[model samples]
Target: MLVDFSAPVAASPAEAEAAAVSAEQVGYDGFGAAETKHDVFTTLALVARATERITLQSGIAVAFARNPMTVAVLANDLQLISEGRFRLGLGSQVKPHIERRFAMPWSRPAARMEEFVAAIRAIWHAWATGERLLFRGEFYKHTLMTEFFDPGPNPHGNPPVELAAVGERMTAVAGRVADGLLVHPLTSVAYLTERILPTVREARGGGLDDFTLGLSAMV
Candidate 1:
């Protein structure tokens, strides 16, 4: 089992760096930051510069707040900076937050999330393999990727995407596309086995041997 550490909320960059180093020194397998007051990517960038071995992750970054291209570029940059120690953890917050808090449009979260993930993957594929990006989804489209805008392939390759989901549709999407699933803290083992696992298995059309499940629980 891999142990992970979460950086505290509203922490300064120095504090984030110290937390990451401490987690690494204490032998944690990974360290992550959530999207709260401080930007998740900025905090992780500081941690990436501070530590060398421990994995860096945005524990839950609001996906709808930014477009796929922005996420792909930032994640790729962090992965390169961390020498492949980065994992992009994306979450689609509720509609109210998406509209009122982030001032971003929100609609059909499950379908939008599915398209969002596909778009990011397509962007990375174009960057990595020089493939033409023609991802045209109902919610997002990416038909342009000039070499001037491309960041090129990272020596470490593309970073893995982990999605956080509580609903069945989003969970199925996670199983279908994401490398990992971030389970909500309110989720129970019974629910995971009876609902989440079965749905995920059906979506993937088999066992989940290669997929990682990140569970959160409160005592």
Candidate 2:
């Protein structure tokens, strides 16, 4: 289990960096940032620069707000900057937030999120292996990658992608594709055993040796 620190709303970047440093000194395994008034990536970037050993993650960055290409670039850059200590945690916000807050399209969320993850992985694969960029999904398509644009492979390899899910469909998608699952804080143990675990097991063919389960709980 990894302990992570989330920066509060009123906290500045400097304060957040200090908190992350303190968390690391106190034996926390990771530091995370939520996409609230302050951007998640920016906060984590600060933490990444300030802390050398602790892992950095975006607790729940909105996926629809940015395209897969943009996400791949940011994650790759952060992975390099953090020396492979970054995990990209993404979430599909509810319809109102997607349409109104992000001013982005709202459709089949689970399907779109699955494609989003796939597209990002495909982009990373293209960069790491020098493969042709040819990922075509229902919601996204990418088939162009020039040497001028490619970042090439990093010394630490590609960053892992974690998906935040509450519903069974999304959970199944995460089980099928994501490296990890970020459980909603409101979830109960009973719900986890009865609904989430079973769905993920079915999706994963009864194997979860490499899958990480992350939960955030209130005191």
Candidate 3:
């Protein structure tokens, strides 16, 4: 079994980095950092600088708390820092956090997340191929990208994006737009087979060739 270590959400950056180092030494296939107490990207960046092999992921970075351009930049930089070993894990937090804590708009979360991922991809494409940044969606708009602000194509290419899902609508969105799906630790086998898999299968057109399904179990 391919095992991954999830850094404690309560751990500080230093603690997480040390844990990640130990995880790598012990032959963990991957390490995931959460976005609870500290910035997930920041913690992962430290972990990335310290480790060489184990894949790094933001167990979840709140997608609604930040814009797509910022997220694209962060993920791109992390991919470079980790030498192509980075995976961007994004999630749309609950409405209270989105609206009150983050002071961001909250409506049609599934649709918004799909557009968010699309916007990030559009920005990366613009940087990679000098394409115009013209992604105008119902929730986000980005029609400008000047050379002065562009970082250009990354050497490691863009990192793969994974989305966390509980509901079928969000799961469908994840299947449609994300490279993978992050299954919650609370997900039951029955629920996965009956609800999640069916939704993803239908959304993915009955194929999961290039898709990754990550389940967090409390083994």
Candidate 4:
């Protein structure tokens, strides 16, 4: 499991660092950081650089805040910096927050998520294949790839892509494509097992193959 270190109640980097270190010392699988009005990636990258052994995850960095191309490059760079200990977790933040706060438009959340994931994969695929990128999606379109911009084949293999999701539609999407599932905390265990897992399982036509299960339990 992972611990969310970002909170309105805690403002100190030292506190977050201490919590991360302590979590590692106590044998936690990973520690997750969330992006808000405050910084998330830089802070978590620092934590990743500071710690050893324990995996560092993004709880769900807002996909709309930056382009999918940017996320692919940044996530790949951080994963490299952390020696492949980084997990890129993405989420489409709520409509109001995304549109009003960030001034980014909101499309169909599920459809946008699907396309965004596809775009990210395309970027990684371009990196791996050393081939020109030719991607066209409902939300994003990238037709060309240049030598200057492409990262070229990640030697460590692309870092795992974790999708933070809640609704049945989103869960089904994750099961069909995502490397991991970031479950909503508000869901009960029974709801997860019965409603959520079944959707995922049904999508996979049986069960997932080593697909990750991440539950957000309130402490």
What TM-score against the true fold does each predicted structure earn? 0.96, 0.96, 0.98, 0.91
lDDT of 2 by residue, 1-219 (tens): 667776674576677889999999988888877887777778778888889998988878899998999999999988988999999999998999989988999899999999999999999999989989999999999999999999998889988889999999999999998999999989999999999999999999998889989898674
Provide the RMSD of all predictions against the true structure, rounded to 1 decimal: 1.2, 1.1, 0.8, 2.1
Instruction: Give the Å error, residue 60, model 2.
Output: 0.8
Ranking by lDDT: 3, 1, 2, 4
lDDT of 4 at 29: 71
Q: Where does the lowest 10-residue lDDT sum fall in candidate 3?
A: 210-219
Q: Which ranges of candidate 2 are over 4 A from the true structure?
A: none
Model 2 — which ten-residue stretch has the worst lDDT?
1-10
lDDT of 4: 0.79
Would you list the clashing residue pairs of candidate 4?
Answer: none
Worst 10 residues of 1 by lDDT: 210-219
Looking at candidate 3, what is the lDDT of residue 161?
95
Clashes found in each candidate (C-alpha, N, C closer than 3 A)? 0, 0, 0, 0
- Which lDDT tens digits does candidate 1 get at residues 32-141? 78888888898888899889899998889899999999999999999988999999999998998999998999999999999999999999999889989899989999
Backbone-clash count (model 3)? 0
Q: On lDDT, who's better, 2 or 4?
A: 2
**Cα lDDT listed for each candidate:** 0.90, 0.90, 0.94, 0.79
Question: Largest lDDT belongs to which candidate?
Answer: 3
